[model samples]
Target: MDTECMHINATLAKSGYDIRVFGVGHYCFNLIHATAIFCLLLSLSSAVGVIILLCKSRTGKSFMTWHKHERFLLYRCICDISYGFVHTLDHAHILITKDHVGPSGLCALYALLIVNTCLSEGLFSLTSALNAFLSVYFRKNVNFGNKDWKLLLLLGIGPFLIAVLVCSLGVLGPNGFFCAFDSVKGVIANAVMSTGMTSAILVALFTFYVLTWYRIYTETKKLKTQLSNNGCARSATLKSAKAMCLFVVVYIIQWTPLSIYGTWQLISDVPFGLFLAVVIMTNLSGVFSGTICLFNKSNKISVSNKDLGERTGHERKS
Candidate 1:
């Protein structure tokens, strides 16, 4: 193993190009690594908070009290934490070794983890949109109890299986410098995987959001009758819709450029500016998720509390 490492290092030194992890200029490198660390901290903190909430709400009654969209946010937190942790380590390894290429095993593991987390992130976004649509359109008729299990299976297990398959097939592995599924391997695996998954998620999110808001608009007249004059149901529905809308925007901002670039790279080389955009946007995902979710969660808590208090007073008067 030592001999292999030495040979790889010597070969890299012989080559004209330096082995760089971020593979960018000095200024861009500083910005990228700085953002990476910030995102790591942000993601882990939010994920820990969500885990605490999940533990506290383990009981059936308590769990059911949360807005349906919040569950998908839980999934997002998990994915962000996983992504952030692995990403931080990748950067650390590159810095400590001062070599763009990390150890083979770690590189492979990084590739696997990245693929799984990214897929889960996209899946959770889709789930959030679906939940919002159902909440608005089906109202009292929609029950996620049975269907949630299926969605959970798809979100949790499906990505793992795909990652395993890709790794085993040797289609997805470490680049000469870092781990990626991209064309760095002279294969279209990264392009195909990223494009297919992202396109599906983006399309579903758009469709769901349109249908959800449209349903909410059409149900305006019936909201009062169906909500029993308390307006709690109506308010909750709007909150869920708003959360989903924000989530979709975040998803697009963070993932779209990279997805498009990955697809484009399959056919031709990507420009340095576009590549920088992808790097910056992808790393910012955790920052976006953490900031947005924290803000929305606080709002939801206050709204729910107010709604509960109002309902209690009305019941007492009756």
Candidate 2:
């Protein structure tokens, strides 16, 4: 969506600028972001609360002893906070200042921030799927022997470095309610890099999740054969499967719309309804992740039945 460039004669305007909101009057503009701020705050609060719930669920356990499942949720919490804080601040700034023009370099920085967090979250999710695979097939979370630091570096620092390149085509400018990639360079960059990367991640997610489900099915069958109480075993296992199903459903829904639609947006104007759907879905992911975490600790079952526990984080790689 090519929003009217706030700076008509600015260098960024020549290249084309896109703000966060579009095709709206001042009143509608304020309404959208005012609502955005509220939702982002809700998501932010949920993420923080989930962290507390996680810590509380392990009240008797050692604080330093991070389990596989707990670790994923913790990573998600940090990402949520990073995104929620920055996004909310951007929206709030616009509302307070009633100015669409962002600070000199803030827009590109914000765009970079968006890419980094997204990449990190996708990586973490892939790691979780790998954890599930290992737990179901090999009966363990990944063991790096003594080179655990390598895994840490990949998860912790890799996204930041990668984002520098992924968003390299992006330039700073007012993008509606917030600052982000300018239109000419930004749109093309997003269409290629963002779509390609997102498609790759989605494909990976689909493959791992399918394998995980197959493993669960086989495990359920094994339990039915070994245990006298076959009904109980199947029921327990299905409950675990249900949790994993939640992640699969939400992930596809969350990512699919934008990735597919973004390419079309390169050629024609983005439909307002589609854009709004993307925003609402994108903003609520933090809420979904945090909500899952809060329930996970309480709903977790024994690893003997559920490789993917309610933590769905698969804490029970047990």
Candidate 3:
């Protein structure tokens, strides 16, 4: 905490937030804390389950033998763990200390961690959209070779580099639930960077997934009509298409409220309902992403373990 930050907090105390409960505003103190704990536990359990599965699968085997989806899911889970860590440690400190922490390192670090994870998670969602699109349309996964440095560059380092810059602009401070851009400049930066970027990602996600499900629909109609007079739809294909839509739905539901809340935070105090909705979405994203990674398996237009291990075959270049 710098002297400047401490002075800002003193000003923020008089602005609107209670400041006693670490600027949580009028929200129920105990409720937010409880939700944060739940988020951490859910994320931990999901991560542990995936780790055990991965470790067991790797026993007496090479890592490269894995299906590409496995690696993607594991990396996404890493982001999940990042979110869980931020909520558990940072939120707890704020509640426990009752706004007494400091001009300190904790809020600064919390801002950095949360922004990095949140942005990375958005990009990861885009990765998933691309994965689904290519799996159906091209029927192959690109193997980046060695350390997956390309993906590491995109998912691992990219958002964090931007996060470092955002923090450097000196907009970090207490928001309603967590410490992030509280100053006017910080709010505008978050509006353009966080909310705006997420909105763009959402549009791209919707476009890709729609094309995928449409491919399934149109091709299924053509092939199936020739085999039967009834021209019956395949139930499994319908189910898979429905399941594909679920991921997009989850991402939209998770981020939209929070994005709206971020923009609203710029003008005036957000209502309790909107505040809680945003909190629930941001924290629970870990649980949602982990669940999708675990249960989402090979499908009709996608590859299974048997196909994944094969060297090559499909309409795809990869």
- What is the C-alpha local distance difference test score of each model? 0.63, 0.63, 0.63
Q: Give the poorly placed runs of model 2, Cα more than 4 Å off.
A: 1-12, 16-21, 24-28, 64-66, 138-140, 144-151, 166-173, 227-249, 294-298, 302-318
Q: Worst ten-residue run, lDDT, model 3?
A: 1-10
Among residues 3 or more apart in sequence or in different chains, the pairs in candidate 2 whose N, CA or C atoms overlap within 3 Å are 18-175, 19-175, 19-176, 20-175, 20-176
Better of 2 and 3 by lDDT: 3
Identify the candidate with maximal lDDT: 3
* Candidate 3: clashing pairs of residues: 1-103, 1-104
| Two-way TM-score contest, 1 vs 3, winner | 3
**Per-residue lDDT for 222-244 in model 1, tens only?**
66566474465466556556666
Error of 1 at 258 (Å): 1.1
Model 2, TM vs. native: 0.77
TM-scores for all candidates: the values are 0.73, 0.77, 0.76
